[model samples]
Target: MLGASTWNADRAQEIVDEHLSLEAPMLPILHALQEEFGYVAPEAAPLLAQALNLSRAEVHGVISFYHDFRHEPAGRHVLKLCRGEACQSMGSEELAEDLFTKLGLDWNRTTRDGELTVEPVYCLGLCASSPAALIDGEPIARLDATTLGEAVDEARGL
Candidate 1:
């Protein structure tokens, strides 16, 4: 399906069983599983549904709803650039375009060297700061082209 070979049946089931036992929010658990594994395996759907007493369609729907859930492995680092109104007002749109052009990649695409994954996020709760971005989950504000480049370099250990 989707030619996305990221899901491992056995691993997905294992993660589902273990994560569901914790009684935490399913979204968080799903996120963790995706983080640990590269993507949420398809087999996780049934297990998650059974554990949460939800329909399989419901579980699938949640996964599909969030942009964060990937059907493929991300590169070594994830660059989540905010596209909220504040960030937009602060020129994030141009900055995003410049970053993509410089990297020769687009949103949800990994670089050829597997060094980075560029993605777009909505509001990161740092709208006031504007032009916020997260490089591997560390949020930073006041972002410009240079700072974004530095963040990418830092994440890649380059």
Candidate 2:
């Protein structure tokens, strides 16, 4: 997770202008916003709507529909666990619960200290080694509690 976005009208306008020329600018604009900010701000919807001549609801829908789009800021380190069928069969569901308990946080929630955030991802294409997870964007296959906890600890600088 990059840091929380510093939401500013000027920055938003600049981003909007940069992508306004694309044939389908919504995705590009949103992606650019996310790239600059950790997630898109709520205010961005209205700005995007005005630029595209669409309703704010339509802009909101597009952002919400994309699983990758984060409405809120993520923690310093993001842990995306696979929830695909292969991983589920390999006990990822159980692992997810275990992590939730260990981290004392549910999916899409950040830790109190904002050191780590746990989120669900459908697949990482690591079926051969199921129960995969991406720790700070680094893919890990055959995930287990011990490894994940260790990584989390490391990520949090514990």
Which candidate has the top score in lDDT? 2
Q: In model 2, which runs have C-alpha deviations exceeding 4 angstroms? A: none
lDDT of each: 0.82, 0.88
Off by over 4 Å in 1: 1-14, 19-25, 50-55
Model 2: per-residue lDDT, tens digit, 80-101? 9999999999999999999898
TM-scores, all candidates, are 0.80, 0.92
Summarize candidate 1's per-residue lDDT along 42-120 as a digit string, tens digits.
7677878887899999999998898777766778788899999989999999999999899899888889988788889
Q: Count the backbone clashes (under 3 Å) in each candidate.
A: 0, 0
On a 0 to 1 TM-score scale, where does candidate 1 land against the true structure?
0.80
Quick one: best TM-score, which candidate? 2
